[model samples]
Target: MSELDAAVAAALSADGHLADLLPGYAPRPEQQEMAAAVADVINQEETLVVEAGTGTGKTLAYLLPALLAGRRTIISTGTRTLQDQLFHRDLPLARQAVNRPVRTALLKGRGNYLCLYRMERTLESGRLENRALADGLQQVRAWSGRTRSGDLAEAPAAASEPALVPRITSTADNCLGQECPLYSECFLMEARRRAQEAEVVVINHHLLMADWALREGGFGEVLPQADVYILDEAHQLPETAARFFGLSVSSRQLFDLARDIRLEQQREAGDAPGLSEQAARLERATADLRLVLGDGMRTAWRTLERPVGEAAEALAHALAEGIAALAPQAPRGKGLESCHRRANSLYQDLQRFLAEPDEGGQVGWVETRGQGFYLRLTPLDVSEQMAGQRARHGRAWVLTSATLAVDGQFGHFLERLGLDDARTLALDSPFDYPNHALLYLPASLPEPSHPDFAEAYLQEAQTVLEASRGRAFLLFTSHRALQTAADWLARRGHHQLLVQGAAPQQQLLDRFREAGDAVLLGTQSFWEGVDVRGPALSCVMIDRLPFGSPADPVLQARMEWMREQGRNPFATYQLPEAVIGLRQGVGRLIRDASDRGVLMLGDVRLVQRGYGRQFLHSLPPMPLTRDPAQVRAFFADQSSTSS
Candidate 1:
C-alpha cells in the first residue's frame, strides 16, 4: 500500500472509544472502497454522488478522509439526531483512531440559540415572566457567565420542559444584531466565532440552505472556506432547500412582535410614538386571518380553503397597501423592524403570485404555521438553479444515502439536483437480508384510493400486530389515515396503543419500549430515523406508499416544472420519490446484523402495479411473501431457531 493507504489502514486497525471501532468490526470491502472513492474526490476537488447502503458505515467513510485530507470541510445531515451523533460520538472517535490534530465544531441555526435580546424581550412580556420561568431564565443568565460555546444545547437545563424552549430560543431574523447592549457576550455570535476556526463544521440542511439564502449570511463568512461538503441523508435536500429558497411571513409572528413592542416600551421607559397603533394594526391583521381561515385545522388539501380566484386577488392588493402603509409607521426596535421586513416580503410575494399564473411562473399558496405564515413562489425548475450553485462553489460535494436511486438508476435524483456530469457510485450492504427480513404484501387489499382501503388495511394490520404481538409501528401516509388506524386499534383495546399527538414523541417511544408488546402508530415523521432495536420493534406495517399529495400546491408546481422540461413527472419524479420514502420506512425494521422483522406494505400496488418492482428492487434483499401463513411460519422458524 502507498503511504496514505497504509496510514488509513493503521487507523482502521487502531483501538478507540467503542470496542466496535476496529478492523474485526471494520467496514466491509465495499464500504472501504467507498471511503477510498470519497478520498479520491476530496483530493481531486470533484463532485461525487455515492449511494452507500444502510450498513455501509458512510459516516466513518467520509470522516476518516475528511480528516486525512486536512481540508476545512462541512458535513450536513438531514436530522439533528445524526448531527449530534457525528459531533459527540463518531467524529471524536475518528480523531482518536487517526490520532490527528483535527479541530471540529458543531454549529446549528441561530434559532437553536437563545438570543439574549429576544429572551429579554420575552421575559418582559408575561410569556416567560412567571417565577418558575424567571428561575429558568436566571439559570441561563448564570450559564452565560461560563459558557464558551454559545450553543443553547450546551446551556444547562435544570428541567426538560417544552415550555422553557421558546423562552430561551431566538432566530436570526428576530435577533437585534450588534446594536443590543448584550451583543458583545451573545451566545449566537460566540458560537459563530468558534466555528470560524474549526476544521470540520457540522451543520444541518436547513442551516446550510439558510446560509445560501443570505439569511444567516454572516456566519457563512465566519466558517473556514471549505474544499468539500458531505451531505448525509441527502434525500431531504430538495424539499429543505426549496423551503429556505422561498419567502415567508405570518400574522402570528407580527402579533408576537406587537406584544413584544408593548413590553419593550414599558421596560425601556421610552415615549415611542406610533408604537401602540402599529401593535393594534398587527392585531387587526391577525384577527382578519383567523376569521377568514375559520376553525379548520386539518393538513389535508380538501379541508383547506385559500381565498383565491378574485377574493385572493383583492386580499393580496389590500395586504400590499396595508404593509406599505404600516412600514413607515412601524417602531424602530429590532422586533418591529423584523416584523415589518417580513410583512413587506410576504406582501410582495403574495402580489407576485396574484399577478402571475403557473403557465411559466411558479404557482403555490400561503399558509400560517406556528409563529409565521409562508408565501412560497417556487420556481418551475430548480435543477438549473441547484446545478449553478454546485458549479459556482469550488468544493467537492458528496451526497450519500441508502435511497438516492430507484431501480439502480440515479437519473431521477441527479436530474432533480442538476448533477448531470457528477461521478456516481453505489455500495451494497454486507448483511444477509434474505435471512433477516420478510416482505409481506397482503394480496387482497384494495387500492390506496378506495374508500374502504384504510379500514381494510387496519383490519389486516391487526392480524400482523397479533402475530408479532404489537411490537410494530403502523405508519400511515396521512394524518387522517393514522388517526383512523389509531382509533380502530384503540377500539380493539387488546394491546397498548400510543398515538402520535396523544403525547410527546419521546414519551410515546418510551411507552412503546417499556410496554414491550405495544403498537405506536404515527405518520411521515416516524418513517425514518426511528431506531427501536430488538423485540420492541419486530414488524413495520405501512398503510400505503408515501406519495406527495397531488393537491399540494408545491407538488403540483413541481410536476408542472417536470412536464415543462419534457419529462413525465409521475415516472421521473413522483415514483422515484415514493420508492425512496418506502425504503426509508421499511429500513426502520432490522437495524442490525442479528435483527429480524417483518415489513408489511399494506399498499396492494406493490404486488398489483407494474411499477411495484422498482420499490422491491430498492429495498434490502429480503424474502418476498404473499402468503400470510408463510409469514407466520417464518416468524415461528426464527423463534424456534433462537430458542
Candidate 2:
C-alpha cells in the first residue's frame, strides 16, 4: 500500500492514532471505508462523490486523511452551525489525534462580520430611531473595540436582532474597500488573510459559490488555490450554484441604494444639486412599482408585459435619470465616489433586468412577498457552469453527504452536478436501524388533496403521539398544512404543543427538549439538521410526501424545460428530490446507536402511488408496519429496555 493509504488505515484501526488519542473512541468499519476512499482521492488527485450515512463519523474520516496528507484543503458546509463545529470542535480534535500542527481558519460571508466604518457612520448619523436600537448600537460599539475577529456572532447585542446586523455590515455595493478609514483593521480582510495562509480553510456553501464563481467583486479572491476541496453537505451545492449563476434585482436593493446616496450627499456635498430630489424620486418610484405588483403575486416574465410593463418602465426611467444627475458630482471623498459608482451599477442592473430576454436555458419571473418585490433570471441548469469551474480549477474534489443518493444510485446527483465520470461510494450507517427504529405507514388515509385529509392525518397522529407520549416532531410540507395541524392539536389539548412560528427555531427546540413530552409542528426548516437523541424525541411524524409545489415558478419552469427535452420530469427531477428530503427527515431519528424511536409517515401515497417503492428503498433498513398496535408495542419495548 502507498504511504497515504497506510496512514489512513492506521488512523482508522481499532488501536490507531485516534483510538490512542481520544478516550472512549470505538472503531467503525464504515468510517474506515470512507477514510480510505478520501485518502485515495488525495493520492490520485481525482474527483470523488460519497454518500456516508449518519453516524458514520464522516467528518473525522475526511479530516484525518487531509491532515495526514498535509494538503491545503478547503472544507465547505451547508450551514453556519456545521461550519463553526468543524472549525472549532472537530478540526481541533482531529488535529490533536493525528498529531499534526496544521494551521486552520474559519471564514464566513461579509454579513457575519462587523464593519467599523458602517457602524460608526450609522451611529454618528443618528439613523437609529428607537431607544432599543440605540442601546443595541452602543453595546455593539463597546463590543467592537475588543473583538479580535470582529465577527458579529461574537457580539451578543448585535446578533440578537436581525435588522441591526445589516445596518452595521458593509455589502459589496456600498463598501469603500481600502479607501475607508477603518480599512487597516477590516474584519473581513483579516479573515481572508488568515484563510489564504491556513492549510485548512472552512467556509459555508454560499461563500464557496461566491468565491468559486467570482460572484461578488468587493470580496476579491477569498479562496486560495488548494489541492483538495471537501464539501460536507454536498447535496446543497447544485441549488446554491444555480442561485449564484443567476441574476437578481429587488425593489429593496434600489431603496437601499437611494438611501445611501442621500446619506453620502449629506455627508460629503452639503445639499448637492438635484441629487436629493432625484434620490427621493427613485425611492418613490420603487415603492410605486411595489404597490402596482401587489402582494403574494408571482408572475412569469412573459405574462408580466401587460399588467406591470408601464410601472416597470417608469421605475427604470427614474433610475436612469438619477444616475445621470449623479454622474457629474465632484469626487468629494471615497464614500461619495462609492455612492456615485453604486448609482451607476444600480442603473445598469435595472436596464438589464428590464430588457433581459428569458431565453437560452434561463427562466425569468417576478415575485412579491409582503412588501418586497424581486425580479430574477435564473438558469434552468447550472451543471455546465459547475463542470467548467471544476475543470478550470483542476483540483481534487471530494463531495460527501448522508442523503445524496436515491435507491443506492448516484445517477441523479451525478447528472445534476455534471460529474458523470467521478468516483462514487455509498457507505451505510453503522447504527442498527431495524433493531432500534420502526417505520409506521399508517393505513386508510384520504388523498393529500382531499379536503378532509388534514383531519384524518391528525386523528392518526394523535394515536401515535399517545403511544409515544407526545415526544414527536410533526413535520409538514406546506405552511397551510402546518397551521391546520397546529390548530387542531391546540383544540385537542392532549399535549403541550410548540408551533413553528411561535418562537425562534432554536428557542423552540430548546423548549421541546426541556418539556420532554411536547409535540413540535414545523415545516421545511425542521426537516433536517436536527439532533434530539434519546427519549426527548421518540417519534418523527411526516405529514406527506415532500414534493415541490408545481405552482412554484422556478420548479414549473424547470419541469417544462425537462419535458421539452423529452425527459421524464417526475422520475428525473421530482421523485429524486422528494426521496432525498424524506431521507433527511427520517435520519433525524435514530441519531446514535443507543438511540431508539418511531417514524410515522402519514402519507398513504407511499404505498398507494407507483413511485413509492423508490422512497421506501432509499430509507434506512427499519422494520416496517401498518398497525397502530405495533407502534405502541415497539415504544413499550423501548421503555422497558431503557429501564
Candidate 2 at 46: error in angstroms? 0.4
Among all windows of 10 consecutive residues in model 1, the one with the lowest summed lDDT is 294-303
Question: TM-score winner among the candidates?
Answer: 2
TM-score of each: 0.89, 0.97
lDDT of prediction 1: 0.73
- State how far residue 298 of model 1 sits from its true place (Å): 8.8
Model 1 stretches astray by more than 4 angstroms: 1-6, 13-24, 125-150, 154-167, 215-222, 267-269, 295-361, 368-373
The root-mean-square deviation over C-alpha atoms between each candidate and the true structure, in angstroms, is 3.6, 1.7
Best by lDDT: 2
Task: Return the number of clashes found in candidate 1.
Answer: 1
lDDT of 1 by residue, 1-643 (tens): 5455555555554343223555456436776778788887876788899998777888888888788877789999988778988899989988876776998889888767766676666556655646787787778767766767656666766323455665566555455677677888787777777788888999988877777767233444434457788999988888887676655544545555556545554554256545555556656665565455544232322234565334444545544554554466456455556556655655665566555534454555655544344444555556776787677665788999877889899988897788898899989776678888898998888999999887788778877877787788888888888887777877888658889989868789988989988888889889887878877888998888888888677777677767877979898878998998998898788777777889999888887889988988888889888888888887787678778
Per-residue lDDT tens digits of candidate 2, residues 416-516?
98997799999999899988899998887888889888898899999998899898999999988999888888898755899999998888999999998
